[model samples]
Target: MISLTPLKMLVLLFSCVLSGALGGYYAASFSPVPAQIAIVDVQALVKKAVEKNQAQTEDDAKALMTKVKSSTEELIQRGVVILDAQSVLTAPEEAYVNIE
Candidate 1:
């Protein structure tokens, strides 16, 4: 037969309360912060994203401009070759095929 005297009952009750309190404290400490209640700098995040996108867009535009210039130059050279093909063929043959 286990008889809990006044002193033992007090100690048992105190231990249970202490253990429960410690457990609650540990659980609270380990709990994740709710997303809706979390702190964040929305403006700073948006600004950073905008800056990154702007820089990427500028770099893309530069690459596109370089490509366009190169393509334009190639087209111009082709046009010149097409326009001068007849003159270029006659120019080299005049001296080589000349019969005296």
Candidate 2:
């Protein structure tokens, strides 16, 4: 059976812990990484935003088309509200009827 004396074992353990701590400190203090920096192209982003706005303006064209359709429906509903006062004519007393 082989055995190390108690005092020699303690000294070896202390030296190993001390060297490991010093190596970690030296590595952290002298790292060679570059610092962070940033740059942005403000004008190009603004131009892209203007283009997006121009594309979005086409929504107004669709809104106007819908408005025209809604107004046509309102006119048809108003025509239905008017009643026939005179009847027994060729078609109606006042309503315009196509003869053909």
Screening candidate 1 with a backbone cut-off below 3 angstroms (N, C-alpha, C), the clashing residue pairs are none
lDDT of 2 by residue, 1-100 (tens): 7687999899999999999999998998898743221122233433555576766455655654454445445445644332222332333223432111
User: What TM-scores do the predictions have?
Assistant: 0.36, 0.38
The regions of model 1 sitting more than 4 angstroms off are 37-100
Residue 57, candidate 2: Cα error in Å is 12
Please report, in order, the local distance difference test score of every candidate based on alpha carbons. Answer: 0.50, 0.49
lDDT of 1 at 31: 98
